[model samples]
Target: EPEVTQTPSHQVTQMGQEVILRCVPISNHLYFYWYRQILGQKVEFLVSFYNNEISEKSEIFDDQFSVERPDGSNFTLKIRSTKLEDSAMYFCASSAGGVHEQFFGPGTRLTVL
Candidate 1:
């Protein structure tokens, strides 16, 4: 069975530093998305990518945040400057299409101090 895989399940960084979270989705999946959930908070959508372009993005995806599909298989989210508030669990998801349910990775827990 195909599944989404993420690297560095947890990360610890300092404020003003940068962090990159990586994910590899099922090969057959098309749509890709990044979402975040602050501790004790609801899940928030960050961005969605399809056909190698950004299909949708939320207000939380500011200039400091960027998403890239570096290769055909990997999707990544980069935060240029980490802030204390950036501490959260970031999830990577993929789906075959709008009609299908999105499959999510285990998530990367980022901690900023």
Candidate 2:
């Protein structure tokens, strides 16, 4: 089965640097999303994008964050200004449609000092 793939399974960064995490979703899926889980917290929805623009974004997705499909197979999440609070497991997900089940990537661990 095709799986969503995320690069740099783990990363360590300083509190004020920029970080860009990459993902490649399943070929036939649509409706991509990004979610984060702080160390011991529940998964929090960050943003959802479709048709090249943001469809929905949660309160957690602020000015520091951005998402883009830079190419046909790559989707990326960039935190322009990282913070200690930004450390978490970021998962990339996609679904065939809004009503279908979402498949998640293994997740990229971002750690800010």
**Candidate number with greatest lDDT:** 1
**How accurate locally, in lDDT, is each candidate?**
0.95, 0.93
RMSD of each: 0.8, 0.8
lDDT of 1 by residue, 49-112 (tens): 9999999999999999999999999999999999999999999999997655899999999999
Q: What is the TM-score of each predicted model, taking all chains together? A: 0.97, 0.97
The deviation in Å at residue 45 for candidate 2 is 0.2
Q: Which residue pairs in candidate 1 have backbone atoms (N, alpha carbon, C) closer than 3 angstroms, thus clashing?
A: none
**Residue ranges of candidate 1 with Cα displaced over 4 Å:** none
Residue 53, model 2: lDDT of: 91
Candidate 2's TM-score reads 0.97
Give stretches of model 2 more than 4 Å off.
none
lDDT of 2 by residue, 4-107 (tens): 99998998999999999999999877789999999989999999988889999999999999999998888899999899999999999988865658899999
